[model samples]
Target: MNVFEGSAGYYGRYRPGLPPEAVALLAGAGSPSSRPRRLLDLGTGTGLAVKALLDRFDDIIALDTDVEMLAIAETDLRWRLPAGVRLSLCHGAAEEFLPPPGWRADLVTICRVFRWLDRPAVLARLNQHVAPDGAVAVLADRSLWTATNPWQQAVRSVVQDFLGPQRRAGSGVFPATPEPFGQTLRASAFSDVTESFVPVRRAWSADGVLGYLYSTSFAAPHLFGDRRDHFEAAVRQVLGCFSDTDTFIEDNTFVIHLGRRPA
Candidate 1:
């Protein structure tokens, strides 16, 4: 079973969008040129990054392995895309996707799902299609599981009790990235690598937290089998103990790593 098999609804409904500052940085990186502007978004879960960039690129290609995820993205983008923008939604993996002949992209973005790809192979593939002045932006951010707040800790404890101590994904445990993302990019064909960080703070309700957990592969609602409601109730009860206002604040750091291929 693929980790994201049945979680497309939760993912599309609960995942947060990229911050304004991060979007601005990506826009600023573009240079004035006569070449056709294209954007390729890999691991584009429910089209978060692609939607954020619809106004910036003339052509957008969004790729994801899950058919259901792409279907949701297609539905959302049909109304969200700006007038005159062309959108292409491809169902494929980052390591295996190939652009049409003569297709080159002005920008490529991989959001939270980069860890699941073969880094070197995908980077090599991007290098073949990235325009001279174009860049590849890799977005990395911590999930709610990394939160240190008391309410978050309590919720995590309840999940651990039901799902066991390991972080479950698909048929295997999630593996950590073997090396720093920056180091991996530096070793690739790209050059002029740089990193930027944006600090973000958001408030979440207990229900919002539950929705967010269900959106992830490790904690989807179906994982609880017939005890889904019971698990949610337990999480709600634990969160209620830590908050009087029914809201918990999350402070997150979003990191963007930009690497450019020589012109």
Candidate 2:
């Protein structure tokens, strides 16, 4: 069963892509100069990160658990692919993905989808597949639930009033604080782990916030069931109180965690 069943449209439209600086950091960690460079993007939601680094790799395979997401991601990247670069999309979860026989990935990237996966198991499996000198880079950013801005807090209150105090993520509840990504990489088979941060500012209109909420696992439209309309009305009311124009700002940081094969 697809957990993010109806979210493809909202996700493709509202989820922000990685900033160029973060993309550059990831690109630098890859083996671009090596011939037949390969990129394996696990959980490639909308192919956002892969789109940024398209030209850096010769062969790319994007994997995702949601079929609809793969469709959107494919449409986004297929036309932009450079000559001699190959792109393939597979529907599978990271924990179940196995590298093709004797084939190794020059770089393996896991973006926002890491928290939904079995962290230790995924890293352990990547040990056998990532190129000798290549890296496994995982990225994540703050969600509105963690934002500190006044308007954001108000919005959260409205969501909680509708969905209860606990956060719902698909079939399970979201962790109040999941273990840090960097710490997980450090304990894996890979070595020379390092962490970096990219500060980002996000601007949102009331409508934009509504669309983004629908795109998230915890606040997906399905979670609201028949009350989605009522929830949206409450969110807009709260947003209106905070800003007559319905504009909001979020100061967020993208955290990148990189681990590499042992030399």
Candidate 3:
């Protein structure tokens, strides 16, 4: 299966275990009443963040490159959308999606999206969409399940080796560090650059973790190929060794960045 196909179920099913810092950063963008009458959600995979934004903004535009992802989002939104909320989904990259003339948004949000973007181009395009006084916020989660724990160090090493090539080529998406990413934001015309880190923990049953692994398009080949059964069995054993309980915890860090266009 392709990346989006194999991975859809995982990201599509997993709920956003948003950290408080992320919430605060979003709130800092503007209060609901003060929020831009117009808003945009860039890389709105499955519309999780879009749903949250809708609570504050009555007019919204969401863009995603994946058509299937948008389809899933549309289904979810149909059920929970509030009255007066309007959403338009654009099937294209953030840098390419054009709003109407004199279009300007009060707020622009890119949650867990930048890792997949061309940093420079996206920053420029995002700048263009925001009203002079508007704010743009970007959020990303750094997966540290393997890196932080001494027991998981070996697992981290193995996973790193697996993802090494993709990381080098910037193909894996998402940055492992925030320094360089923050630098790009700083170099832009945006002001009041503030970033906060929030720690999150997710509990997963054995099958759930297995499903998550299989859902990764990059790791699917390793998890579901000739060694499929073997790999799953090994995962069960490794997780079992790590936990005395039926579930395991994924400890991660989410970083939120907030900046504003010049007024």
Best prediction by lDDT = 2
Query: Which ranges in model 2 have alpha carbons more than 4 Å from their true place?
Result: none
Candidates 1 and 2 compared by TM-score, better number? 1
After the best TM-score superposition of candidate 1, give how far the Cα of residue 33 lies from its true spot, in angstroms. 4.3
Q: What is the lDDT of residue 260 in candidate 2?
A: 81
- What's the residue-level lDDT of 102 in candidate 2? 75
lDDT-based ranking: 2, 1, 3
lDDT of 1 at 241: 90
Clashing pairs in 3: 115-174
TM-score of each: 0.95, 0.94, 0.82
Q: Distance (Å) between predicted and true CA of 179, model 3?
A: 6.3
TM-score, prediction 3? 0.82
Kindly list the per-residue Cα lDDT of model 2 for residues 1-263, writing each as its tens digit: 35675788999999888988898898888676777898999999889888988988888888998888899998988999999998989998788888778778888999978887898999888888878878899988888887788888898888889888898776567756668888888889866788899999888998899988888877888888999889999999889887766678888898888888666
Quote the lDDT for 54 in model 3.
Answer: 63
Tens digit per residue, CA lDDT, model 1, 87-175: 99999889988999988888889887888889999999888887778888898788866677667778888988889888877546778
Local distance difference test, candidate 2: 0.85
Show the colliding residue pairs in model 2: none
Provide the lDDT at 252 for model 1: 83
Best of the candidates, TM-score: 1
* Model 1 quality (TM-score): 0.95
lDDT of 3 by residue, 1-263 (tens): 23455455566775454665576567557334553377888988788777765676777888998787888888888677688777887889887868878777777788766766787787788778777777777777754332375334444444445455342222344345444556778777675687878888777776776665544444544433475666666666666777788666667777777776544
Tell how far residue 31 is off in model 2, in angstroms: 2.3
